[model samples]
Target: MADSVRSPRERYREQVRDEVKRHAWEQIASAGVTALSLNAIAKEMGMSGPALYRYFASRDELITALIRDAYRSLADTVRAAAEGGTTAVALAGVIRGWALQDPHRYLLIYGTPVPGYHAPEDITAISDELLAVLLVVCADPAAEDQKSPFDVLLGAKRGWVAKVLASPRTVHRALSFWTRVQGVLSLELAGHFAPMGIDPGLLLAEEVAEL
Candidate 1:
């Protein structure tokens, strides 16, 4: 038991921090972010509130951490999809897959904005990375005739902002795709479709086809 009493390596703190964040994520999944409470989380962990404060200076810090993680996860998902294939179609499928797996988490990033809520710089940076992946997937030199609103908006440069101004149609397609997909996802997550007797998968496929 003496060895158990000994502290783990300082590096372990990061692991502990992740564990806390994972629990926090679970909480967010079950309930909206507005429902998150540190005391409740501590109780869920079978610890006192003070224990979590050691890692998160305040509730805001914990929320910021979660937002950052959400962005990173999205960036990784898009990056993996881009690396896996060409076709904007496939990339759009990847985005839908990620959103379906955890709609609540996706909304945490793109859902209705809260009043007075400001995201940290890293969140926007990660979001840009995700968009960059989309730009790469959508860019088609051979299919210049198929340019969308985004292509015109994005113009010639395909980096960050260039992707924004290339083709207006492509930009509209991207935004519409995102909003439609999220609309379906948000509705499903909120159980709004149960009464309508419509299959979300069908709606998702149709939206993807439009993209």
Candidate 2:
């Protein structure tokens, strides 16, 4: 309600910012993130470079906004699945579906690092939300029977995991699950599996079922 009651000036500013981000995504699609130019976007939007700077102080700031949006979106999707009593396998499927729906957004967050770009601490907070949901869904009682060496090491500092009330083994399991899913998505998005006649979806199902 408070948001809807925002003054006209605030609403217009947000609209402009949103428009700039749309153009920025188009630029990212055509060229890479390194090729993003605020000045170019200003020309495309009929605004001077300095004027656009009022909306986004620097390219890094705009990139942060994009990254934050991406992470927040994935976090929300997984959180919803978790709240709906999604199982480990089902949650993995949900994540896979989300990635398939928007490969660009998925890659933007988890793909190669943007050179000279450092994500703010808030981005880490959003990513931690993802891990938290993974931990919840990955709590397998059968996993408690097997203790790997890595699990033993991870058990020592269960600081964050403890906050989520997940065992060290569950944390290990969640990490394993996340890495496998990400590996498949990264390779699949890059079109590496097509040439090999490999089915990424089947591969993902097998990987998640193993957990």
Candidate 3:
């Protein structure tokens, strides 16, 4: 089915929403999400705080939208790379590029949880979507029989195996790849490597190569 065309008012609203999100990200980058203020944002944009509420019902609603966009962006990035026949290492490189381009956006999803903020179920659903992609990238069509202790454990869980249809080996590799990348990225982005005088990029590249 084709996408329905938007009316002029709808288009304007969408544009403003994007702009609002951009400013929200900047604010979060500087003072953290706990300090995100719709009124402050409004003041900066020269609009009344109540007027902004027309677009977002509450602060939590806006934060939820930001989280959704972050997850969606990462999911789309990985899916595109995988669909283009990229390998795990190459895909990891793409992820690193995405994170480097907007470190705050990357952290917004994976970094420390916002105080007093609990994500909704849709956030978990988007996360599962991302995991499904990793399962796809990890699968080896010719090597179905390979398994490890963890793979055996995962295989016994019929609920998920029945859904993702990935072999234990694929799942193991995918999880290992995910953890390694996350470990490197979280530390690197947190500025832990700067004090050590070691290159985080080379470390990340080496880890990917090992995988």
TM per candidate comes to 0.75, 0.94, 0.89
- Top TM-score: which candidate number? 2
Report RMSD (Å) for each prediction in the order shown: 5.1, 1.6, 2.4
lDDT winner, 2 or 3: 2
Better structure of 1 and 2 per TM-score: 2
**Which residues of candidate 2, in runs, are more than 4 Å off?**
1-3, 158-164
Candidate 1 lDDT, 58-152, residue by residue in tens: 77788888888878888898787778765655665676678778777788887876445688887787887766665555554556677655556
Q: Order the numbered candidates by lDDT, best leading.
A: 2, 3, 1
Can you write out model 2's per-residue Cα lDDT over 86-191, one digit (the tens) per residue? 8877887889899999787888899889999999999999999999888877888886979889888877774665676778899898999999999988899999
Where model 1 places Cα greater than 4 Å from the true spot, the runs are 1-8, 114-116, 140-169
Superposed model 3: Cα runs more than 4 Å off: 1-4, 141-146
Q: Which stretch of 10 consecutive residues in model 1 shows the poorest summed lDDT? A: 161-170
Span of 10 residues, lowest total lDDT, candidate 2: 156-165
- CA lDDT, every model vs. true structure: 0.72, 0.89, 0.85
